[model samples]
Target chain A: GGIITQTPKFLIGQEGQKLTLKCQQNFNHDTMYWYRQDSGKGLRLIYYSITENDLQKGDLSEGYDASREKKSSFSLTVTSAQKNEMAVFLCASSKDWGANTLYFGAGTRLSVL
Target chain B: AQSVTQPDARVTVSEGASLQLRCKYSYSGTPYLFWYVQYPRQGLQLLLKYYSGDPVVQGVNGFEAEFIKSNSSFHLRKASVHWSDSAVYFCAVSPNYGNEKITFGAGTKLTIKP
Candidate 1:
């Protein structure tokens, strides 16, 4: 079985600072996604890429930018961190779009001071 | 637009007892439902999925979920509970068509009493 790896298990950022999170997958999947998890809000999709160099915004795409540099790697950038935006960011990959199963990474916990 | 709701935020059950977590969804077209579990310090794992045909879908670790289209509900159940079963359970839904985002519920935290 393949694995999805996310770098930087934890992140601390100051208000208005820019932070980036990276993800890599060995599954050779065609689709990758970034989701933000809040305490009571569950997981909200921020952005997704169907293939390399493709990006699509989701319900919660504001203040976030995503890049799919290659088939195996995807990255997310927080344009300007907010003090109230402490949350866990998850990276997931799927074989394809639609009703496919999503394989997820452990996630990066972010806190803004 | 599609949406999911998991009413109960937390539930505690005795060990060896039956378990059930409620989930409801709203979508205009056909809905593909899923149940995912998250253990402590771990990423989410799919427990089961309901595409079509049978309403009852079985998942790993003896977990099962029944899809009630009439009620727009999909509830996860287990015959017996164990301490290891304690975790956060999320309900998700996706449109039948491709290129759409999957929406997830708020999730329910399950606790098992030893």
Candidate 2:
């Protein structure tokens, strides 16, 4: 059994500020993903990595950057925070790639003032 | 591009009663469907998924979903409801080929009334 851990469960940033969120998974999965969750909006894929040092853009990839420096770690960076913006970012990992069940982290709630 | 739709934004059912949540999707090729549940203050968890073979897939905690290809719908159901079942449910769709990128619905919030 393994767990996906997301750092800084709650995040606060100022408008135009850059913020970064981190994720770590011990599952040793081959793929990692970053998703943004808004109230009633479900989850949107921001970016995903098939393996270390690889990245693929999703529908909502703009204004976000992701890094897969290590197979166990993935990080997301917000280019510029927007005022009154609030959302929860979730990190997930899968054994392989397509059609596999994903293991998720608790998520990091972000609030920009 | 593939998309998913969850018609019901909110659903409330009495405890021990049957439950159903509606979902619809759009895709040109073969679609892979999935149902995910998000408990309060937690990330989404897989409830069930349909790739091929069976149209009806069973999931954890007595949850199940049936895929109706003709209607382009994958609906989630439960024989009985419990208070702990209250959560937000999302329907997702993925393409069959290449690196699959999942598209999710707006989501349906379910509340169990005792």
Candidate 3:
């Protein structure tokens, strides 16, 4: 069994601060994605990487940046945190793209003050 | 654009009662549907998926979902409810053949009343 590990289960940041969250998966999946979950907005994709060094922006990629340093690691950075932007960041990976079941990390909760 | 709509934002039922959560999706061609559950302060867990073949797909924890293509809906059902089943359920859809570019609905929060 493979597990998706997310670092710093909770994040507390000040407004305008640039916070980074990390994700690591041992499943060796080819695709990794980062999503932001608001209270009632569901989950919005921020970015994804098909492979190491590859990146694709999703619907909610405006204030975020992602990096797939290695096949096992994917990281996301919040450009400038806002008070209203406090939400949970989730990381997921899939064996392949589309219609495939996704493996998810526990997620990192961000609170902006 | 591919999208999902979960009409009920919150649903409450008593233990041992039947459970149903609604999900509607939008896509021009054949669509890929999925139901995921998230426990408090946790990540989303795949409950079931519908692609091809049988209209009814079974998932973990005795959960099942039926895909009604005619109605453009996929609804999750469980015969008996348990307190552990309390969680936030999300419905999502993908346009392409596979899981590409998926969109999620706002999600339905299920609460079990004893």
Candidate 4:
């Protein structure tokens, strides 16, 4: 059994500040993903990595940058935090690309002032 | 692009009663559908998924979802409800042949009443 751990469960950033969220998974999966969850918008894919040093943009990757330096970890950076912005960032991993089981981290709640 | 629609924004059910949550998807080719549950202050967890084979798939915690290709719907159902079942449910689809990128619905918040 493995667990996906997300650091800084709660994040607070000033408007226009840059923030980074970290995720670590011991599952040793080949794919990792970052998703943003909003009040009425549900979960939107930010970015995903198929393997180490691989990256793919999703529907909502405009203001975000993702890194897959290591297979066990993935990180997301917010280019510029917007005022009154609030959302939950979730990290997930999969065994492979095809019809695989995805495991998620607790998530980082972001709030901007 | 593949998309999902969860028509119900919120649903409330009494304890020990039956439950059903609606979901609809749009895709050009063979579709892969998924249902996920998010408990309070937690990340979303897969309740069940449909790739091929069976149309009615059983998921965790006595939950089941039926996929009707004609209607383009995959609705989740449960025979009995518990207070712990209160959570937000999301329907998702993998439009591409593989699971590269998935689209999700707005989600339906389920509240169980005792």
DockQ metric for all predictions: 0.79, 0.70, 0.74, 0.66
Residue pairs in clash, model 1: none
TM-score of 1: 0.98
* DockQ head-to-head 3 vs 4, winner: 3
lDDT of 4 by residue, A1-113 (tens): 89999998999999999999999999989999999999988988899999887999978999999999799999999999999999999999998875567899999999999
lDDT by residue for model 2 (A17-81), tens: 99999999999999999999988787889999998878999779999999997999999999999
lDDT per residue for candidate 1 within A1-113, as digits (tens), equals 99999988999999999999999999999999999999889999999998887899988999998899999999999999998668999999999877899999999999999
- The residue ranges of model 4 lying beyond 4 angstroms of the native Cα positions read none
Candidate 1: what lDDT? 0.94
For residue B15, give model 2's deviation from the true position in Å.
0.7
Please, what are the lDDT tens digits per residue for candidate 4 over residues B1-114?
Answer: 778999999999999999999999988788888999999998889999998998999999999999899999999999999999999999998854685477789999999988
The better-scoring model by lDDT among 2 and 4 is 2
> What DockQ class does candidate 4 belong to?
medium
Clashes found in each candidate (C-alpha, N, C closer than 3 A): 0, 0, 5, 0
lDDT of each: 0.94, 0.93, 0.92, 0.92
lDDT of 2 by residue, B1-114 (tens): 898889899999999999999999999889889899999988889999999988999999999999999999999999999999999999999898747778889999999999
